[model samples]
Target chain A: MSTTISPKNAVQVEASAEVKAVHQQMLRQQRLNRAATYAVAILLVLWILVPIYLIASMAFTTPAAVRAYPKGVLPFIPFSFETMNFFLQSEGIIPGVINSIIVAIITLVLSTLIAAPAGYATSRFLFPGRDFYRLSVLAVRAFPIVVLSIPLAVVFINLGMYDSVYSLALMHTALALPTTILVIGSVFASIPFELEEAAQVFGCTPFEAFRHVVLPLVLPGIAAAAVFTFVMSWNEVFAASILTVQNRTLPAQVLAVLGQSSEPYQFAGAFFMMIPALIFIFFIRRYLFNMWGQVSK
Target chain B: MNEEKQSTQKKRKKINWAPYWLILPSLIYLALFFIWPMFRGLGLAVYNDEAALSLQTEPSRDAATAGTLPQGTQVEILDQQGNLIPPDEAGQANVITEVWYQISAEDADGNTVEGWVSESRIRVREENEAGAPTAGSVRTRIGAGDTLTEVYSEPNENAEVAGQLEARAEVAITDQSILEIWYQVRGEDRNQTVEGWAQSRYIQVFGETNTGRIDRGNTGQFTTEYLSKMVNDRFFWPATITTFLLMILIIPVQFVLAIVMALVIQARLKGNSLFLYVFTIPLGISELAVGILWFSIFTQSGFLNSFLQTTGLINTPITFLSADTRYWIIIAIWLAEVWRATSIVMVIVVSGLQAISDEVLEAAELFGASLWQRVRHVILPMLKPSLQVALILRTILALQVFAVVIALSGGDVVTVLANETYRQYSEFRNANVAAAYAGLILLISMGSAVIYLRMIRSQEEMAA
Candidate 1:
């Protein structure tokens, strides 16, 4: 609202003083609001990142420094891999990691395989029981893990499948299936149904239409769902601990001895568990909404 | 016309079963793993394993004793001596006579024992019955008692007391008394090969075979003792109250913080996607790791203390995770939960915010509404459904908070429902009590969900 009162136009100045002052006040207020927003946003970013950074420092530092009081916030002065290395070399760590990876892979395959067709059916077919199925899936998605794991553990043991990685994968699949179906269902819903119809009209069979036109578009979202399934299984500790004895997953293994483990082992173990998740989220950052958002709706 | 009418009738009669077929596997899987276990957990909460069978050497009532089998023991029927009576229209007794079967099974010592078990003693294992205890894997705890549990060399009370083991000691079932009153157990001593016998009543037999999940009694009779035990536990109220308190404290703060973060991203400022990524980073992190990460911060000589000391805000590092500082432990857990979980809420909120079209916000801006007014009037109302979803999600998860409390506070100073459930299941070897805790948690979670649903529905009605 600033008016130019140059010498040539001095007799023709327009904007009132009150209006200029009000405009200036409004601009200042907007600037203040922007600064506040940035401040809050950056503070939140730090809130999430700083703990991770602190744990990472503890992980990368020498074991001696990890135990020292008034510890350094950063690991740079004499960064050492000693702590993380010690954790990795420790008994059962390798086996635990192997078990975690296997279980996650199995869970990813099983959940995605089982949920894909269901997701497709719900999104496309408009079947009679579709709403009931979808609502139940939604309900089951929020089921407490404790209730499911304890009994399933008993069931697995009865079937003589307990303490095996795949048995755990089965349990993890059950946990992830509901969310997977909902997410993949929404993914399918996003693709236009007429595209599949057009492919069929062009002489592609229904299956051929699905395999060629629709599959290519939805594959990434389904893969993201699968990756999340893997992450869920990888990050889960309670069920893994309850369901398996010898075939403990990484989180369960770390938790099993966390009470007796030293500070370095604990920190390094936490950092190790967090690494895949951090990277996985980075890759699937585009589908964060696709995975979680539509489910909320 | 007749041909066309017939064809139309045929077309009308046919039903599409393709979608049903597509969803069948998932439905069955949920039925088995989700629905069945929930009922099984409920059953576990209500039942205790208290049934046993005495194996007679002969079919006669006066026969000599051969061995004993705990309920749920798998035995192969070698011979039968009586007819199976059918239930009549009057609903009379199904067994007309005392039936007996000669059965063979491996004993606790891996030796096969052959004996006559009466029909009344053995429940028929249904064709679809899941696997039973493989004859010798019974692990029981010495039930609560202050006095030392005296173990006899023989099943008889007159037999010499071989040793006295401490209460709450775990023992493997090596043998059982023929009279079904005592169990020969191998106690905690490592060097002792031959352990002694303890009375069955003093031995608390939770249906945990050596290598399986906790099972309720195979006898199929329900009991309220486990549920009562959970309710009567010393830590029950503290854990329950703390669980709810944490939920109450954490969820609102989380929603607010999440909304702010969501708004920041929605502001479309420079590098907001980077901010979105940073905020959602914790969505991938596990609760156990989050607990450990925060433990590193709040531990003695940890990051928080280090920072405070470096800045001269404190002279010495505080013992934040100790028993005397229980509130601090709770705070540490609160902070950890907030840090780890708010991201989920933020993502949901951001999506909800995105669904609000730009024109509505522009309309509000053109109407000269303040930022606060726009959020209060135009934004939050639109965000209700998302908020409801986030609230329910956060609350349910908050109830099940386990490792964070344990990791930060050692679970001694502060406890939650899930921790108590784990303690009952793993440490105490009491599956029934653990199931009780799990059932209680589920109940509360469902109650909260129902409440949230109703609240939102009512609010929507009010607005309508």
Candidate 2:
């Protein structure tokens, strides 16, 4: 299948080879940059891992060993469930943990219910005072928790609902509500309005259109909001402390014991308080950037 | 007919109020719990004191009188016209008939002005009425220990005496201005130095006076009540105010720091991702844990002091957690907050950076734009949306900061809104007040979110 070629085509092939050589050199430099980036990434990952390791190690160790001078980098003895048991049986830890879970769950549900529809309306509608509503939410977001907690304590007392888990959950929902709305709003905005219109054209009511077209698309963002809300409620202490006594949440319980606890219990309590949040963060890692970015924007 | 048809078309586009109904639950929660309670809390702070005073008007002017003022004695005004008189002259108000005084008279060296005139000290004195016969001479004498006696006679016969008169009464000088004589004196003398202590008809050859309004035996009960009142009064209000103020200060600072860190990391500097991960490591730590960690470093014999001493930066170890230096602990916590929370901003910013198309940057580069120009024109415009979101999120979280301060200072040096709320609900068992605090926080959080959304909306419009 040998055939004669034109001189013009032959010259063009030589020029293409030269261009390819330059591109290969640039690719080599890019590869070197990527290697350096990867090395740093590994070190950064270790920095986060080490402290967590230390906390876990301390939580598992006996009090005597924890107080031992020149504390070992690793647990000297075999891991014990004693520390965990101690935490579970401590003054208010178990009840607090349970209350924290209940409050967080309630907050997640209530905030999601309240925020999703508002978020959709915010993104889709051009209603009067829409801008005003947006600004109001932002202002609320900026208000200090302390300032509100004290006054709210008084209000709760007047309402005959002091020191209840319900109060804490309500307050936590308020804390999470604005972010929830913003997150879901952005998610709703990203889905084209045309999709809803199409659903309506296919014999769906406005509510049905949203249910079929918009809900499914924004479900990921809503899930992310729910997860973040749960984490926030779980981690919160101020409102929990202000709103509860015997019915304390985990973080509030940890805070109450902060000054009085033995070193081992203190470390254990801290560890226990953080586990849920850490696990939540890990589970939501994929959506962390997307969800937060949308909510913030 | 065409115009009418167009008007009908516009009317068809009107929105139903269904969305407003959807938001009603949150609105009701906000109004009942947040908005209304805030006004109520403010009312409590301002109006609660009036309820404690007696409501009688002109019942007896004797009740309004202050204690004896020594001849030519300078008395510093404690409170005037219901306002606290400052140490400086700026606080002096016009003298009023219905005044309560807490006068402190000190010598040049600032010691209490006290002196011994005689064993039964005698000083000639005139009563408030100039023409009336002298209420004799008041004889002051030191008995045993911290006891004194004042003897005086009411020589005026024409004085309207409605109360019983007693002689040889025991009296004590309770405070600088108070002479609590146990006998009744004639007429109401609101201007007399020894007012509100006893009736003016009280006179004695030598008597000890008790001028205090409260009985010493029942002091423990009074103190407990007073403490509870103070907690309800000065402590709660100031604490709440301080918490809100600190939050306002911290939230913006934290937000700016976080945003700055995010922007710096996203600028694609050397080891950017590594720095980001390092920044984020602190976020894994609980606020209390972080507070404790920093406290260990900042306490009197902690790492900071040791470092300073070893470096010869100071002669002695500093007390970072002492009453004097606890402010530094607050600063340290702020630093810890930056370390822990900045990672959040970095993460948010990085995501935003990724969202921007590379083509825009490449186009800018093709135009031979400088780094600053590209950042100013290309990068920032794209990042505004993320910045708005970051601001709202950080502000809301920062406003609620509590555990860190409590863990670090144990409510000694710092108190925030959350701490006050905690104290009210947990320690004081005042749920109504705690709910009020929660209500304020809700308002603040919602308000900030609204602001952030509006800003982003405007920016979007501007960009368009």
Candidate 3:
């Protein structure tokens, strides 16, 4: 074979072998990278999920299950609805959950209504007080609703509106307004101004252009803003606790009755409050950056 | 067509009335709800609301407060606002006005300190005030956080003990002896109506003072008593400092975690969005939910202790949420907050990272720069704006921290300024101090925001 093989052929065969070895090494490296990626992804997923799993386990299992010396992380033990049923059937909880929904809805509507225009104004046109408006939105961050709710409580009482969902909704709107305005403004800004201009050139009035062209484009962002506002209002405790007496939101009610209830009720209540939030978070995943990223830019 | 188009154009081409109109609703709402209330809160904090009546700590005319209502003493006011509501009926007997304050408040903070009237002198406002309780029956304010344990089945001093009653649980007396040392009482607790024999001497009995305490009224928005309560409230300084510290501590750590998370998610790997979705799932959970969920882990006999005990780490389950180890409660709360809110920073960082052009990174790599060097010189500088935003927002939100602590601590052993503000209004019935606390929080939050804003600005942006 050595006699039959020319030196050039031998050299070519050696080069081909080298190329095949290099290709094999690259494939192995790629597989290693992929394995690393999957490991990290799984680790992160578990990190995010394990707490939720523990909570869900507690909520679904019996009180004894929670007290188990070695607590089970998963809901593998026979499921029991007794805790959740008791919480759901409890007198204060139903109205509380409903009031939370109502308050959140009101917050969403009010924040969106106020923020959309304010945001649109800031995004579309530069006015004299534009910087002031922008800075003030940032400035509102300085004051917690805790401080504001005190005076608002008094005012709401004077207005004969204290301890009602409306007063609470109003406070929530104020809290939600700053972020809504900023987020929605950025949303509108991201849409090309040329789109609205194009609509106007085609015989649409400016308002008509916004209503038809700009609005549909910004709806998803607005929806995201609405979700954020809803989550905020739903989760809010301080203002709800302060501003209302009889008509308490879920978090406020939970705070009020926290000590009185048993542990199972606590877990159930906590898990119950999370149900709507879980659903909404899935809806708003794409818009989180749209909501938060604009601030930094 | 030309005329109509010209006319429409003329109407549209004028000053942009649109933006101002668009912004009006927000301005009006803010003015009505936000700005006005903030100003009023600050103003109300300084002004001493005229006392509906001057508060007398001792029920005597010397007007000495022997100082505020003594804890555990109860007052049955024939009239709460003796003469405040209807000035025309000043000093006159109008016994029907409602007592807006609690009837049997055990907690001193929950007690509205009107003026105190000594025993037997309460009906002195009138020859026979209709407001006085019937001859034998008496009102009682339970002592703050005191458990009325001896629920004897019989009225006798030594009877079979029934199940005990909880704190702040109240009852009406059906029968009692002189000085009411032992009384027959009944009250409802959750599912059952409880009848029990209790001793006035042992239990925290608040009411039936010969003279009632009157809250002249919150005439002076600022009262010395109110100020003292605000300063001295158990939760005041501790909560305030905790809130400040928690925000300060968590912001840096949260930023680090967020960056790592952002880096991980930005790895150009498949299913990275799933990571984003999972990580930010917590963002959706309310503070109440997070706190409660974590509480199950940290409580005595909870998951952590359970795990510890199972692993033979200790002889007994540790009470992590107990007042003796309240610092651990704060740590648990910090854990819950970090777990729930770090994603907010992560999302912002990811957005910032996403905005960075890969070309620049490749160029930096092309310059023989190491990953650390490139990250320091390029990535960090560009990520500054995002970090600043996350820092400012998180700090502001953290300063307003309320629900998490409430869920974990149950308003005991731990408190924050926001929680104190709530206590001032709801528990103490003092809105002025509540406002002041809020104002302080606002000042701090704004100050922090200003610091972050100034500190993190890029040189070019700062120069410009």
Q: Give candidate 3's error at residue B70 in angstroms.
A: 22
The local distance difference test score of each candidate is 0.79, 0.60, 0.72
* DockQ-based ranking: 1, 3, 2
Interface RMSD of 1: 1.0
TM-score of 3: 0.73
A141: Cα error in model 1, Å: 0.8
RMSD of each: 12.1, 15.6, 14.9
Top DockQ model: 1
**Which residues of candidate 1, in runs, are more than 4 Å off?**
A1-28, B1-12, B49-218
Ranking by lDDT: 1, 3, 2
The all-Cα superposition gives candidate 2 an RMSD in Å to the true structure of 15.6
Q: Quote the B-chain TM-score, candidate 3.
A: 0.60
Each candidate's chain B TM-score?
0.67, 0.48, 0.60
Q: What is the TM-score of chain A alone in each candidate?
A: 0.92, 0.86, 0.86
* TM-score for each of the candidates: 0.78, 0.62, 0.73
